[model samples]
Target: MSKINHFKGVLFDLDGTLLDTIGDITYAINSALIVVGAEPITTSQCKGLVGRGLKNALKGALELKNREVTPSQLEELVPQMLGSYHRHPYRHTHPYEGVEALLDDLAKEGIALGVLSNKADSLVQPIIRGVLPTHSFVFIRGDKEGWPSKPEPDGVYAFSEAVGVPVDQLLLVGDSEVDYYTAEAAQVDVAIATWGFRSRERLLEAGCRNLYSSVEELRKEVFPWL
Candidate 1:
């Protein structure tokens, strides 16, 4: 294996990277679709729609059913979706296999950890707290007002500053092209976790080379010292 660059901090993408949140996300999307009288989407379909943000996912869900939602219409529907999701965020969501252990090990190794996700801040904090309450993240930020979402470098930059780590000394671990682009724009190392939402083929086509098929593989390769 090639030598992995040492990182002082690691910023993880929440939805797919750390947690298997598709069940709740899909539920939210379908709830909004129902409010708009559109047919619900399957989990697989929802997978392709996520990674940008909930608004974009809702818009894509509408498009899948040949329904084009106006901005005003979407504005009305978003609350219903968010409300439904909030009611049952943890009903189906949980940390991915080995994720809790990995986080624990990383913490023990003195690695600063944070979460930077495109999911709404309201949802992100609660979900992380509910699912992985034991781990204390240095920073947990999501899509909030005045903060640009990822694939843009703003979130990553903010995370680096918040964690007191330079961009080059940080690693962004995620599961989508959006995450790959976010790391690229921020000039940080990125490790793509294929066990999440996107397939290895899709991630590779997005120019992601450091692909980890499993959490253990990621630990062994990226933090071999642990």
Candidate 2:
């Protein structure tokens, strides 16, 4: 266990780290694109496009194929896409192995837990309820008006404030460069999940402080301080 995993509370990054919702998101995005008379993208393509908010995700998906849609076109299609996802955020989504157990163990120890994601609020709750019902997270926040998402410190800072813990007392767990940047911007410790979107090399390049290859590893490393 690395010394960095020790912390009082944890703020988790949702999309690629805690839950694998990329398949469902990809389906919705492709459907929206088709409705807009644009081409569709594959699940693999969608994985690379995630982590940022939905707007950026869709923009990246379109850009990957050299397809460009106006901001108005994207805005018009977003609600439909999100509505589709809201209807079935977990049909093809599943928790990474050991995540449920990890959450359970952490909660048992009275460690604070919260979810911070670029995913919209309406969609994040249902997915969590569907996939991790027993995980007693203290708060689950999503992208909102005026609050900058990950890669910016706003969400993490807000999370720490909500948890009644100092920013330095929290551990940010995630799987992307954006996550690392969020932790850095918040001046908190970070634990990168190997099972998510970005590669370990990419995470290191982004200045990740620690890495966990599995949920069990995360539990072992993080629970000691509880």
Among all candidates shown, the one with the greatest TM-score: 1
Give one digit per residue, the lDDT tens place, for model 2 in 98-140.
Answer: 7777777777767789999998887888889888887789889
Best by lDDT: 1
Candidate 2: lDDT of 31?
70
Error of 1 at 148 (Å): 1.0
Give the per-residue lDDT of model 1 (tens digit) for 88-189: 887888888999998998898888999999999999988988999999899999999999899999988888899898887899999999998898898888
The collision pairs in model 1 are: none
What TM-score does candidate 1 get on C-alpha atoms? 0.96
Off-target runs (Cα >4 Å) in candidate 2 are 1-6, 224-226
TM-score of every model versus the real structure: 0.96, 0.91
* Backbone clashes (count) for model 1: 0
Instruction: Give Cα distance to truth, residue 165, candidate 2, Å.
Output: 1.4
